[model samples]
Target: MSKDYLSVMPEDFSDFGLSQPILKAIDQSGYTEPTPIQTQMIPSVMEGRDVIGQAQTGTGKTAAFALPLLNGLRQKKKASPQILVLAPTRELALQVADSFKKYGTYINNLKVLAIYGGEEYSGQLRQLSKGVNIVVGTPGRVMDHIRRGSLKLDTIQSFILDEADEMLKMGFLEDVEWILEQAPQQKQIALFSATMPSSIRRIAATHLHDPVEITIRSKTATASTINQKFLITNGMNAKKEALGRILEVSETDGVLTFVRTKMQTVELAEFLTELGYQAAPLNGDIPQNQRLRTVEQLKSGKIDILVATDVAARGLDVERVSHVINFDIPFDTESYIHRIGRTGRAGRTGEAILLLAPREKSMLKSIERASRRKIEMMHMPSVNEVNKKRIEAYKSRITKTLTEDCSFFDDLIRDYCSETEASVEQVAAALAKLVQGNSPMLLEEKKYERREKRERKQPVGGRNNRRSSGRSDEGMERYRIAVGESHGVKPGNIVGAIANEVDMDSEYIGRISIYDEYSTVDLPAGMPRQLMKVLHNARINGRMMKLSREGEKSSGSERFGNRKNGGKPRRSNPKTSRKPRTASAV
Candidate 1:
């Protein structure tokens, strides 16, 4: 099948018998066709069969399961919940609940409640007392409600475990199993997870009865429509400055910047606004009305930039978003995909730019691999580029006002030129200088270069001095750190920790080899034993280092024991590979 044929189209929603209101909501949300998960799972769900869905985070899985559950609800059904969804995180619960509300808009007399931690429980209790048709909640809170008798699942006809693997990882599998036991034995169960490990499969085997399995894998590892790129920065402040420079240079109609924390969403938005950009923060705390308005502003050009956390920005569709900026590198590869997906949507081409402190280069590589696309290197915009863009913007503004409000500004400019005995060209030049004064654009070239130098100077290896040691072509014994793959260590962490602990240039760090459990990096061939000991004692990822040879042992042996040895080899476990050694002797 052609790539486009395999992908979800907007028209797929038509077959679902969605009421006009729900249809309108979907259309407004920029969904035209159903995703594969939606297409295959929706029908099965509406048929009231338990479903087992395997799809990644960005595959529109929420709507896939939610729409069908809503469709199955009878208009006359009692206020007690007909469906319950258990999610791993509070943010995920809220997101799923919002999806339910949006898709069930036309389902008359339907009520949905989202219950999660860190919120007032009295309001939830009141909602429960009034009765609701659907409840989306985190595992812990749902268990609490069940214990308190505030939540009664006797009438629930459908149950869903979203992000089942995540819940398992968070040690909530016991709670999930307990909750499942509490539900009626006849209830339908739907379990969705990106990756189904043995534990997840067991849950499916025990709960779903001969369930139809649907798996949709993206043919192209990464969204081909997205242009991914990255810029290297020194630290937090330099990253902000570089972001400002990029915003000025990139030709984007609207931009969505992803950050790791809710606090960062606010702080980054504030910084952008202070720089005279139309920017706003979108987070879970923002009222629904305000969030909708912010999204509208972004689409309509009232706001040019949006800073948001991954969860808060879920289900947002703004076709005009031409660029996605990763202000903070995501915690995982899946998040990276979702963040960039905010752009390059609906067959539109978009650009995704990632800002990485010197140490984060390793994570950047992982992101590139996970997305299955090469992320191009983007040089931090130079002072000259910023200045050039500023001049262009200034001229454009002047030209627009001159044409649209000629009478208002033309005479004033003329009067000023005449009174000062200066030519109009000279007057305009002076005005331009005044307008562009003291901005990042006017910063000295040396300042930018110095900042870049500092960024490059930051440490580039792992947290501890567990340098990956290797021999150079000249037979020089080179000692480096194994801060890379072994402990999920990113280049940024390596660089930051090294620079902070030892006065060394991040650039001096040589080639790095990242393995699942450990990484081998090249550094200066010879270093004092005491310095190497200091590095070993240093912590990365909050763990001490015990460095080993890079590529010296087969990664396969480390990961899976040799079958020859009764499947229990004596070598180190790949999953627990320690840090690389700084010196060969060590």
Candidate 2:
């Protein structure tokens, strides 16, 4: 039977009958009350019953499972993976393993290892030989270890699947099934997914035994202290320009900017440095120790801006990160939530600004629904506004100098005035010119005014007086890709890959529809063969999508863009404003 929870939560972890050790760790984490997911999930897992959770990302699901699992852990002398956690990505595997280690810190004789494909196998092999109570890994690497006889599942007491639906979408359903069969001796199975698709449901039915299902239906809203906002920016140049102006006008001590790719982190950081902001780039390629040092610098105010990707910025908690700027729109609401979460710490108000083009505006609604808050439209910071801010700061500097003991400078200036017979005002004006250097005290407004005029004249939904791929689209034409719903592809993956490969703004892309065997996308109605070749070779979900015109042979020559149900378009990725499906958030 299925169970759902929408009631008042307990105020403390002690109410869940947790062990003293687990309770102590919870207290150290500064969590005074249990989240909705933790409140609903802890009791079931403590009862040793299988659980299936329907939660969206950012609902505190990790702690929900980790706390209960740690509370019941019985450290054995010969640890051979008493509990197994299968994740979709190596990054998640590491995160989950870290949580396990943290929560179980008070327990004696506890060991955890995160195994994935890219890392060296010798290290993993050494860990396994040393004996670990918990083994968290990706499906492929786990399967490899199982085949190599390094990982044995007969001793596993519980098996957990984190983000089961994501694994299915990433084409890991078969691998997950194989892992499940290998652990038939496991006592209970815990499956967590954002949504309950038919495939996931089938696996739950086949694997779990009389499970207690829990769903946290509460509105997953962002922190009320954050002022969520968005800017309608088109081309890359426009985004960079807007960023500089916001940085100048915003009341921020430190800013964290997120981008989609590592290359963008470097490029945007360099651009910000050129515009007179102390900025640095952070990505996964950077060593772990260096990443920590960079975060430390941000906290100490040595650098005011840090350009980073999602993975690099994970678990970053800095009280001074007052602003989070999304230089590029995130493909999913979960990522949007994670990005903004870096700020709004230590009871201070935070600001999250999303930069969106005309085409990417559709994602705005998804982010709002997931966050359960309205992101008000933010006016582009005008040149006049920037000038006013600079003038204030300049005057403050002058006031500070006047308060200091300037006796020697005053005497020297008096001597100069007497020698030249110039008035004190004239001498002060010359000194002010020296302080200002060659640059004007106020920002020039002519270029900004001309750009505003051009923006006002541009047509709706077109790039703001800028072409995306160095060419303007006359109109849109429908095209088909070899990937489809069967391949577990989403529209954002299609849009992200296309926009990145061609260096074009997402605003040029049009409506998309996913079908059973193939998908349809609307692109610029063009006759360029070279660009077509580049797109044709683009891969999605590790499969080369043979992108071709609609009604092509590779598309099965069937025009099903309009389905039998009233000839309407069906976009399946973005969820409705009511119930969100992602549950990977902390």
Candidate 3:
């Protein structure tokens, strides 16, 4: 239902029957009205019904559930967790838990805890022992707590699974199912997914009962109000210069710059701050309190620029964000969408600019395909253009000062001009020069290269793709490993572990034969001593291979007892016989 951009949002939150405290919190959150997902899903969830909310990433689903859950906190009072929320990632867990705390600020005796990996257990333990009203965490960590008998779900009134589809994609479906089984039968269940695949549907069928289904799909991954553009930058130097130029010319009110790593966030923020933009770095390592403070600063216009990672910026809904600059492209299209969605939110018009290196053209194509909009190339600002912008800004500042009461500065400048033999304009020019530090007001022109052509002409195969580097065409050598059927080792397992260690392709693997207690395989001759030594400790299915060249007594035919059966045709290498189809099917 949210897909229709023409739909009118709710007039107010009172219509949803939320509590006064929640209303106050929402007011503080600056959400004047509810999004479509919130409008449709809030009332149903408030009534304590099973809900299946299907919505895209930017539909404000977190608040839709968080508000109602907090509103009913008094209905079932318990020191144990009354609400259990499962997210696919720790970052999401942190964000959702923060929201619950924000919405429940006025609700007395309310306590929430976020438990996830990459954290010390002592803090989480202390919070749980002290008593908590809600527990939000990733599935794996939740399972850990359950098995350790630290997290109890018997008193849970509400169980929420956020981003069900993401969990499924990340191979956590089984873990989710197991956790659902642990919840109390009397609890209300809510499952949310962006796209309901068969696995997620099966989960809903198995756990949720008579759920009210809600779906929100936008026409495009990004709002049409967002003007998207890309700049072809060749490397870090060019990309940095391009970023400075773009911000110099573009409308940069509350700009959010996305980078790939935590280190990049700090480095780029420092760079931008040096360039005179008030920028802050945000990443996972920052304390949660500090992170929240940083977010509030950005929201309140205390800072004009925020450089953040995808995880750090997830679920941010700041209306002041006027632009999103992708300093480093995301690994997936979903992340790309989430990154740009920081701007152009709440039906507001915004700009999104992406910097692309030559090697990232394919990723650019993927993003274009996913966003379903043509991202036109950006025009790099010339030296003359930068100078013009600087001049305009300078004149505008001077005009504003003239409008204000600057009598103190005016008298001082007049006295100085009289003492020296200088005109008023010359004195003003000298002050302007002093105000403008050593940093140049304008940037020198930098040339941009079209590296896409070179990228396209590059060949694919390299030494990394080889199964065995420097393996001569003469013949092969037979090797033996002390792992086989008895140890539950399969040919495919052997092939995978060895190939992965050397960054090789599996298709080029040679013949393999497995016995009850051991296995023999033919490999390219003249194996490097270093590679052989590394392979000695290569493990498969938790058992070290202890790999070594056969004692040179066993021939290929003698190793395979079923040679008469002729299991299968060998790899297409000219020097080999039929490769036995023992267990290398994978």
Candidate 4:
């Protein structure tokens, strides 16, 4: 095949020979053109042949397989599943299931059920008992149903392993193989992975019968439709503030913010909500139904932003998503591609903003090489810019109110003005005040109260000065550590260990005061649970240094002193032993 063949995008879905019902469904879906993967793989899948499709996450692989499979399915309820699709995560499973249902909307008697962990199984078992033409699930949950005799694959006509490489990365390859082995030998198997690693290729060779290979290689690394830009982070805690500012100034219809961890997803979402953005969290730990509801909210513009982990946002296809902000930079190139893929989908132009710390700047170069495109350096919207935008929005709202026919409100306004003997402008101003509520129309710039922490002066003294002047200031959180001066631990020990272990800059770490049996260190608040766990188990001076937030008695260090103290005990005892402190907060 010519190189151009791999990049061929069809003008329409009609050439794929889809049934009228499925074609109508596609037209209703607002998709006028077939993506490269769909254009190449649809016909092969319809021919009842095993196919191996290699394409990136947003290349329309779901429809590539789903359309053909739906078209070929006989419109009748069956006792056994006709098609089984194994996705690595619950989000992806639900996504694939939705796709199947959408394409088969016009086809009668087509029941698609999504089964995954973290959800009650009774409903799924009931659905399976009634008969589902298609079953989309994670491997472990699918295996559970299989073992329980609820899902029988003996009559399955086809098996699909979506994101096979992701399954391998998630350590689901074994479960996937076991599920594949259990399927009837007569069934055709189709495997789609972004990258065909040796392990995935081995599985294909073992299970598929002369599989037709289809690869959709994009002509460009990054999608041309997406405007990719990067913003240098102020510090570890500034992502939320920067994101808020960006949203304030940018024309975002809907946003998908990618964080590194599940806990961070919730943290960022809550933070955004506190900042007056309609945001919600999407993660693996959230119940499947709630997650779906959150996605629906984002789709309907009820939620303007969705803070999500990389895994949770997989296969999330929301058309209104106009911006993707990498609140946490992805660790790899492929993840970057998949994350930005959430936007700029189906040929729509979208914006992708990446927040990068100074240390993470190298990853930008790596990603640039991998994507074969330059990520333009972007200056975050200034506080002044945000204020201007907010004021403009307020003015626009007032202007819109003028254009609106307010006969209904006019009576109330006239009555209120007459009763109060007020002027028209006064009534209008009062109404605007009520409409604005507590929301601020302008933002103030607080230099020290930003994402980047200001450099603090190093505490002067030896370990014995631990009780001296190390005190927690406002905006800083104190954490207790089990390893202290009694264990020959110095201030340098705590700073070095935390900075190295947590991948944090020393400048961000605040005051460190070592006590006899424990120590207190001031740090940023709202740390993710994963990082806290890692820090809790951190070892120093050959001792397990248990770290926990100051107020929380998780570490049983409250007896030592108030956690808010920099290092000074609120009430000092001469009998309390201490060592010489060196290298206080850097």
CA-only RMSD, every prediction:
11.5, 10.7, 10.8, 7.5
Write one digit per residue (lDDT tens) for candidate 3, span 173-237: 89999999988988899888877879899988888888888776562434687899988765465
Ordered from best to worst TM-score, the candidate numbers read 4, 2, 1, 3
Worst 10 residues of 3 by lDDT: 460-469
Clashing pairs in model 4, backbone N/Cα/C closer than 3 A = 462-581, 463-580, 463-581, 470-566, 471-566
Clashes of 1: 27
Model 4, stretches more than 4 Å misplaced?
Answer: 1-8, 75-79, 219-222, 405-440, 445-586
The residue-by-residue lDDT of candidate 4 on 388-475, one tens digit each, is 8888998887789889898988898889888999998988887778887887566657863452345223221112233434555423
Per-residue lDDT tens digits for candidate 1, residues 1-586, read 0112264544658788865767777787778778667877877888888788876655678888887777667665458888999987665777788888888876678799999876778999999999899999989999999999999989989999998877865678999999999999998898888777899999888988878887766623227778989988665677789899898888989999987666778899999999899999988777755776888798789999999977677546667989999987765566677678777765678899998766567777777676667789989787888888877886788788767746867889889888988999898777777876766446588866776777677654323343333234211233334343546777666656655665444534545544444444554433333345556566778865444333343222242212355322134456887544232211
Error of 1 at 160 (Å): 1.6
Model 1 regions more than 4 Å off = 1-11, 15-30, 219-222, 234-238, 253-274, 278-321, 345-349, 357-365, 403-409, 412-420, 436-443, 450-459, 462-586
Off by over 4 Å in 3: 1-33, 74-78, 105-108, 117-123, 168-175, 197-199, 219-222, 285-297, 300-302, 358-369, 372-376, 399-409, 445-586
lDDT of each residue in 1-586, candidate 2, tens digit only: 6777768889788998988988888788677887677888889998889999987655667888888888888777777788899988665787788888878879888899989876778999999999998999999999999999999998888899998877865678889998999886557889998778799999998999999888865444236767899999866677888999899998888999988767778899999999888999988777655765787898899999999876567556667888999987765676677678777643457899999876677789877887788899999897789999998998899899999999999999989999999999998889889988997767678877788778666555532322112333324566677776767888788888777776544665665656655666667554244456677788998877778877564533544333554333233355543322111100
Q: Give Cα-based local distance difference scores for all models.
A: 0.72, 0.77, 0.76, 0.80
Q: How many angstroms is residue 29 displaced in model 3 relative to the true structure, after the best TM-score fit?
A: 4.6
Q: Which ten residues in a row have the lowest lDDT in candidate 1?
A: 468-477
lDDT for model 1, on a 0 to 1 scale?
Answer: 0.72
Predicted structure 4, TM vs. truth: 0.75
